[model samples]
Target: MADIHITIHNKTFATATEPTIADFTLSLVSGEFVCLVGASGCGKTTLLNIIADLDYDYDGDIVVGQQHKSPKIGYIFQNPRLLPWRTVRENIELALPDDYAGDVVDNLLDIMQLTPHQHVYADRLSLGMGRRVSIIRAFAVNPELLLMDEPFVSLDPPTARQVRALLLQLWQQRPHTVLFVTHDLREAITLADKLIFLSANPMQIISEVLVAIPRNERNNELAVENFRQQLLNEHPDIKQLL
Candidate 1:
């Protein structure tokens, strides 16, 4: 588990007239599941990239873990991005660090119900199955910080629900500090310990809501809906931000 602190003073592109992120700061406690909710085309994905060290052109300071040292990060994108030539298990094993000890590939594949497909080529697996492989790959690294950007998007309802359950089950066992970005409010409500609402046009956090409902009770649709209703009723203006 790792604590993440991000502060973007001014992030802009050369061709852009204005900054994408300015004077924005957010903190994630170790082992906290925080979700970022915003409209399409917002800088949510960019923020994730910055945190994952995939983009460093931005003017920002990102510190992870207790000693301020670089922490191992696992990132799952919208697409699985797996190698077509690699088998499911191979894809997962490829993510392991050279110095890392122990083999988690088999256990992760078993837990994700991908054992039967472990020998299958990545090109042959369905979207949902490929996504499961990607999830396993991310977790195989035993990351202290995990960043997911709409990992379940474009999936069917049932498949998405199933994947979410599996993801949560693994997360509960490992407790990685996670920052998940989603456009679905209900998905955020279901997965997040804290909900961060963002606004576009220089994306920045506008509101944050704590999910007071217990993790065990979040699976109840009625309870989730009631909590959503209460949130809206309490912060009527937050609706505009969403």
Candidate 2:
């Protein structure tokens, strides 16, 4: 895996006179899952858009690998963006390169546990199932980096937990660099190897914390709770309601 260095220097974006993010700087490594947690107007989504190359108007340098090439990026939004007219398999297949669609879709369907629901249409699937299809689609193209903005936000608690587990499993299997944005602290702690806490409007990186506990051991309830509390203590700003 290659290292991904992101440097945001004196970057600012505004709607009229209102600034979204300003003077932000952060670096993330490849194969690391990092989460950005902040308040509603803190520009978490805006920052993600910048990194995804969707918003380039900001004044700053956002670089990826050594070659400086635009790396392949996959984005999963709050809502599953599956095409309503397409079957589940077809939706996932849409992400694949045109020449290799057959093999890629078959493999991703099996990996995401969508084999049984392969022929089902998007409207007929449950929320959880729809989300799985969305994830499958994102991974089908084998992006070098994956950016997710609260991809599981709409699911029930139990379903969210299940999807979280599935996400970790798939991440371990492919090991792509991931930047997941969420207001849920526990979700951030559980899924991220590193966590960034951002301030309110005109967002800037306030703190960065590394979770040293091994991934396999992250599920221990007591340990997770202790770690969560430690994070809250270190960065009390995390307690603020988003």
TM-score of every candidate relative to the true structure: 0.94, 0.92
lDDT on C-alpha atoms for all candidate structures: 0.86, 0.81
Best by TM-score: 1
Taking the tens digit of each residue's C-alpha lDDT, what string does model 1 give over 113-186? 98899999999999999999998889888787889999999999999999999999988876788899998888
When summed lDDT is taken over every stretch of 10 residues in candidate 1, the lowest stretch is: 62-71
Error at 154, model 1, angstroms:
0.3
Q: After superposition, how far is residue 150 of candidate 2 from its true place, in Å?
A: 0.5
lDDT of candidate model 1 versus the reference: 0.86
Predict model 2's lDDT versus the native.
0.81
- Which runs of model 2 end up more than 4 angstroms from their true locations? 10-14
Could you tell me which residue pairs clash in candidate 2?
A: none
